[model samples]
Each structure stands twice: as C-alpha cells, then as structure tokens.
Target: MKYPKIRELKEAIVSLLTPAYTSKFPAEPHVPFEKFRGKPSVDDENCVGCETCANVCPSHAITFTDDKEKGIRTIIRDYGKCIFCGQCEEHCITKKGVILSDKIYDMAVFDRSKSIEYQEKELLICQSCNAIITTREHLHFMHRKLGPKAFSSILNLNILNQKLRLAEGQDVSVEIKDGLKRKDMFNIICPNCLRVILVKYLSKGV
Candidate 1:
C-alpha cells in the first residue's frame, strides 16, 4: 500500500492528539457553531400565513391548504422534509415569522409526524361568490405595509367591519341576489365580484 505523504502524516498525527473535532451530541448537549442554520422556528403571532414560505420552500417543506367552506387556511411545516436552506426565514414577508433556531439543530426523530407542525389562520372568503380573498392576517399585514393607501380599496376596509362591527344590524347578507349590488361592495368581496359591481355601476352612468 502507498504510504501517506509527509504533510498528510503530520496532519494525521496532529488530529490524533487533538480532542474530538465534533460535538458530543448524544452524550452531551450539542453546541452549534456560530452562524449555524438549523431548524425553522415559527412565530405564530407574526406568521400571517400568506403562503410565502410555502411558495419559496425548495423542498416543499411548507405547505398550505385553504378551506373556503370553513374560512380557514391551514399551514403545515414538515421538518422531516426540510433541507434547512433558510429560504423560509430569508423570504418571510413579516421578517420574523420563521427564524432558524441555531439551538434546535438536532431534528432526529423516528416518527416523522413528530417533526411536523400545523398553523391555522382565518381566511377571508368573498361574500358574493364564496371565493377566497386571503388570510385575515395577510390582509392586515398588507394594510400595515400600504398605510393610508390601502383604504383606497374597499377590500382593505373589511378589517374595520370585523373590529368595529359596522354592519352588525344591516341586512347585507351575501344571499347572491339576481346579481351583486352596490350595497355588497363594502362587504368582504373578491376582485371578480367587485369588478362586476363597478362595471354594472359605470354602465348605468347614474
């Protein structure tokens, strides 16, 4: 067999004399090195469930399911499928929604389900056609980002109705009259329904 070069032999000797070059994970708690990108830690309070992470995840570790009937958006984050590329954290719209927890590097688990997590956000379904507008939190995030300009769109005002109960006693039920009327424009409506209303009004020229 060919012998190791002088430099290689010297390196082997030095490595042998040195303590373990790796962390004693099982025996001792793992101490991740600086700038270590580990498992993603979600902040529910900050996560708007906008599907940004799910869209950017290269490995499809994050996924979302919308239930229009229930008006809920479910987000599933499977750490078992995560490559820990830190894309979720890097592209988070809220900037603090998903963060890489350097301390949570060890994700070894027998049950894959144990490594999966779920989050739910209230979805804003269009009252006219039952179409999904977006998550309420995502709309709120948009409002914060757009500031005063967001009020230009009646859709943005949906949040006020939720908090102020502006139409609590009004008979603005979305029973889908012959066609969507102007009265339903203020309600949480999809762009398609709103377009119909706008066109109907502009056509009348009254």
Candidate 2:
C-alpha cells in the first residue's frame, strides 16, 4: 500500500486496462503481400506449345504433348500439387508474360485423389497451313490472316473444297454459280484450303 508496493499495483492495473495491441482477425481482415499466389493462367493465343514450362517444373505439375504432323501441341496444368514455384511462368515461351493470380489460393479440397489434374481440351493447329480445322472461330481467324483477294481466288477455293471434302466427306460443298437472275449451286472448301490452292496455282504458273 505504500512506496514500491503501491507503484507495482498501479502499474499492473494500468496494463490490464490498456487496449489489446494484437490483431482481431475475425473483426478485421489481414492483408497479404502484393505477389500472392492465386490461380494460374495461360494466354492460349500466345502459347507456342514449346513445353518448356513442363520440362522445367520441379513438381511435374505441367504436361504438354506435341502433334508433329499438325505442328500443334496440348498443355495440361495440375494445380493440386503445385508448389507455387513460378518456374513454369518463368520458362513460358510467351513473350507477353505470365504471372500468378491473387484469387484461388483457398481452392484446396478434401478429396486428394480428385484434386490431382483436370484435363483441358486443346485445339489442333496446323503449322505450315496455319489451319484451325477443329473449330469455326479458328477458321475465321485463319481467313482473317489470309485477307480478301487471296481468299476469293478460284484455285484457292477449289483446293480448299478438296481438303474440306477429304476431311468432311464429298457430300459437303461450297460452290455457288450465277447471280440473282439464274442461280446455280456448287460446293466450296474452307478458307485454309483456298490459300493452299493459291500456292499450287502460283507454282504451276497457270
């Protein structure tokens, strides 16, 4: 109650009355670092199918298969066992860039077996012809690259038709003749085949 005893009691009381300094997590959110690892992404348009990412990955979380004849490749990413090493992103062939996201960190699940790898469908791309035969959008993309004048050439049209017929069968046609007055019907090949036809025509000098 006096001198040293009084001072010690007062100090203890004051400390107990002071506000808590530690974080109240549920009441207040915690902030993470700027480069937090979230989900991974791939810009398919830029991906050259090099498989460099799969080769360098320490965890073997990435897999890529190449189609030599078509010159197209497929990639699959397994995020379950991913170590967030950033090695894949570093080795990616895309010059634009690849980076981790801040969204999917809590994606872990109780089913370990099911969490292994999710397969994604890949597009079959032609290296030399640059044809996207699988989907219509890819066909349009190829056509856009080839442009109009080259697109309309008769030889190119016939060649394109031949390829389409070979792949889609002879029943499919893309030919059209005459105008609004005297309409005619015909079969036509897709745009990719058209370009190939043009190349053949030029070589023949016909």
Q: Report, for every candidate in turn, its global Cα lDDT versus the true structure.
A: 0.86, 0.53
**121-190 in candidate 2: lDDT tens per residue?**
3444332343443432234444555777544654335345555564355443222323211111123333
Model number with the top lDDT? 1
RMSD of each: 2.9, 11.2
The window of 10 residues in a row where model 1 has the poorest summed lDDT is 169-178
Error of 1 at 59 (Å): 0.2
Using TM-score, give the best candidate's number: 1
lDDT of 1 by residue, 73-184 (tens): 9999999999989999999999999999998888878888999999999998877788787898999899889999998988887666765788686543355656787877
Question: 150 in model 1: Cα distance from truth in Å?
Answer: 1.0
Give stretches of model 1 more than 4 Å off. Answer: 1-17, 171-175
